[model samples]
Target: MTSIEIRHNLFDNPEVSGTEYKTVELIIKKLQIYHPDILTSDIKDGHGVIAIFKGKKQGKNIAFRTDIDALPSGHRCGHDGHTAILLQFAEYIVSGNRPETGSIILIFQPEEETGNGAKKILQSKVLQNLHVDYIFGLHNLPGYHLGNILFKYGTFAAASTGFIAKLEGKQAHAAYPENGINPAKAVADFILALDSFKNDDISNFKQITVIHVNIGEIAFGTAAGDANVMLTLRSFTNKGMSELINNVTSELQQLANKYSLKVSYDFQDKFNALENDDVCVDIVKAAAKELNMTTESLPEPMRWSEDFADYCLKWHGGFFGIGSGENCKPLHNPEYNFPDELIDIGAKMFLKIAEQAMVD
Candidate 1:
């Protein structure tokens, strides 16, 4: 099948994070037809597919990963395009355009939107047994010029975690408010304290945003006895994030004690900051130069978080961005869609990188 057709097929049938059974099935079917050499759809616990293409002479085992899961809002993140790029690249490898030496592994990872897919894949014996020497991945950037490649040397993205704080107190009758405890004041104070955790330092890149707040419901006759706050915390470094989390926890505990309320908190959607290896980044630049494609070096790391950081941490690799178009809608926006033109561009880039890795 053509790359465009495959991309549309994956985009039309969207699956939310953690449930990509049909997506995996379709990917496996295509890989079997195109590559057929090494394909594994072995479902143990996590959802993912691995395809290996061995070359004439073995040198280094290089892997390229692409996320296969879509957001609850649908394929607004362009994972469909990413997956199609890898699939087409696989087709290129198997159609006698194999690397001169070494092998290539294509990974279709699941649940990336939930921030646990890469971790689960790494833990699974499937990837651990491959012993990949180098890994690479890419995401499409909507605001850049079409076909332009963007690279960063270190800290490509931020470390982030979803913070949730809950408080409980005794409800009080409206007529006699002092008879029981009310948590409204505690919630208000906690919000203020949480905001205080945001460091204004430009280098640290720390931020705290309150996403949700809830107090006891609408029956106006009773004072609110319980409250909760949901926040997203981010930093450029893990140390900075740890410090912010510790400070927030300490302040929240103090506020709970002062207000005489029971308190509990938990974190979700945790992501480590992405640090790109300098050597791997040079390979991307060289590949772009070889293709005569435009390239840009970002001045600062993106505030968004990506699970690809997990793979880069384990292997000496780099993750870069491909431009969708200058006027295209941003990722996760309802109007956003992956452009069909990027399929060939991304696939060629990955193929070039694989060739370079084989020779280097």
Candidate 2:
């Protein structure tokens, strides 16, 4: 198969936010071409696509996943590279393969950019009905070099939540300050209050905690009727995150009330921390070792969050990120791309990991 062409196709698809259903559908069609028996279906209005490949021997059921969704920025986070690896691997596995141990389920999920797809899938009965023994997932990382695997035994990623705070103020004319309440000043005060809460008093708080608040918009020359603050709260543990969120919310509410402004708060997308089981990590590391690839041991935890955490909540599983290239590019960057060489290595590693874990 032409790996370059597959990569190009995946990258060029442009499966941006909230509309990844079409991309998943296309991948399903491509996989169906290789394995006629590969059953494919859409779950929750194309939010997720499920495909199953049955093995000859009767073993436990297992699953390997890759998210198919792209960010609104489109191709900025190297999501195209992820989809290509998954499609290529699915084709390699289901084409009358000789592995005689267990079945493989390939899931291409949507809405990952918003961190809601996995949670929605968990709520449904589909994954519960499959009785899957284990699950595996991976993401691309620049600067790590291509064709390299990074594995962690536990708590690989942090917990995160996106928040929106609405404030009400009486709008006043730009020239006439006394005519009505000026929300612009209140909004500025609220932002300052939120930033003040970013205290470095607690040890490790600087390393693990992050609080970002930005004023969304403001209007003048009218009664300051509405204002909003968009904030993101994150931490490595549930306790830290809960504490931080509560602290900031209380502070912001108090400041809004002091300014005689009405306040409302809501959370948009939430991603739980990723905790990898020891057995699953061992399985992945052993498979990488067999492939003669140097597996870098990740001893430190990452503060980024992923929806894959939802899958781990149900079944004992693990997730990691591969070094796609050297001089690692941060995610959500337009210049990033998933290295083509890792397609073969990633697929082979996945196949080995599956056989090792499920094929008795």
Candidate 3:
């Protein structure tokens, strides 16, 4: 099938993270045509697909990874096109494109939106057993000319996590005169404390966004006994992320103590910063150059978290972006569309990168 056909098939049957059952089936059917040396879909995560293409000679094991799940609303992030691009690359390899030394591992990773797929795969020891030397993945970026290659030396994307603070205290009647403890002060202070981190003189970039807060019911008949504060914490580097978490935790703990409130903390959807290896970046750049594609080096790391960072932490990995188009809608937007034109461009880029990685 053509890349567009595969993309549309995926787009039509969009599946959310942790539930790419049908999506995985379609990917398997398309990849079966290529007959990878090893095609296994039922792995640790149950949704990740691993395909290994053996080389005529043993040398370097290069893995090309792609996310296969879409957002809950739909394929707002264009993962359908990502799957199609890697599938097309799989087809090219079977069409007499063999590696010079080591095998090529193609990963159709699931739950990328939830930041769990890569970690689960790693725990499965799939890539660990393969001893992959270099890994690569690409994401589509809007607001640039179509087919433009975007690259950065390090921290292509930031690390981010969702934090929830649940505060519990005694409730009393509204008419009570300081008869019971209230968590309102703690919640307010927590927000202000986190906000202060924005001015930290730390070397790493950091940010905190207060997404939500809940104190009491609308009845207004009773004093508030509980509160919840939801925030998104972000940092440009993994070290920075660690520091951010530490700072937030310490401050929140202090507030809970001062207010005599029983506070519980939970961090969700944690994504480590995407660190691009210089060597892998140059190889990708050379591959782009060979394809004669226009390339741009980003001035700063994107302020978004990417799960691909999990793979890079274990192996020499590089992550880059392909321009969807100058007028393409931002990702995750309800009305955003994955440009069909990107299918061919992404497929070509993936194929070139794979073919070149095989020999180099």
lDDT of 1 at 316: 89
Q: Which ten residues in a row have the lowest lDDT in candidate 1?
A: 35-44
Candidates ranked, most accurate by TM-score first = 3, 1, 2
* Tens-digit per-residue lDDT, 253-347, candidate 2: 78777777778888877877777878889888888988898789765667678888888888888787788778656787766666777777887
Each model's backbone clash number: 0, 11, 3
The weakest ten consecutive residues by lDDT in model 3 span 195-204
Cα displacement (angstroms), candidate 1, residue 98, comes to: 2.5
10 residues in a row with least lDDT, candidate 2: 201-210
lDDT of 3 by residue, 252-308 (tens): 888888989887899999999999999889988988999899999988888888899
The root-mean-square deviation over C-alpha atoms between each candidate and the true structure, in angstroms, is 1.8, 3.7, 1.7
By the lDDT metric, which is better: model 1 or model 2?
1
Q: Which stretches of candidate 2 lie above 4 Å from their native place?
A: 1-3, 36-38, 56-58, 95-102, 123-125, 171-190, 193-226, 256-260, 327-329
Whole-model Cα lDDT per candidate? Answer: 0.87, 0.72, 0.86
lDDT of 1 by residue, 17-58 (tens): 888989998898888887545788664577789888876775
RMSD of 3: 1.7
lDDT of 1: 0.87
Residue 115 in model 3: lDDT: 93
Higher-scoring candidate on TM-score, 1 or 2 = 1
- My TM-score estimates for the predictions, one after another, are 0.94, 0.83, 0.95
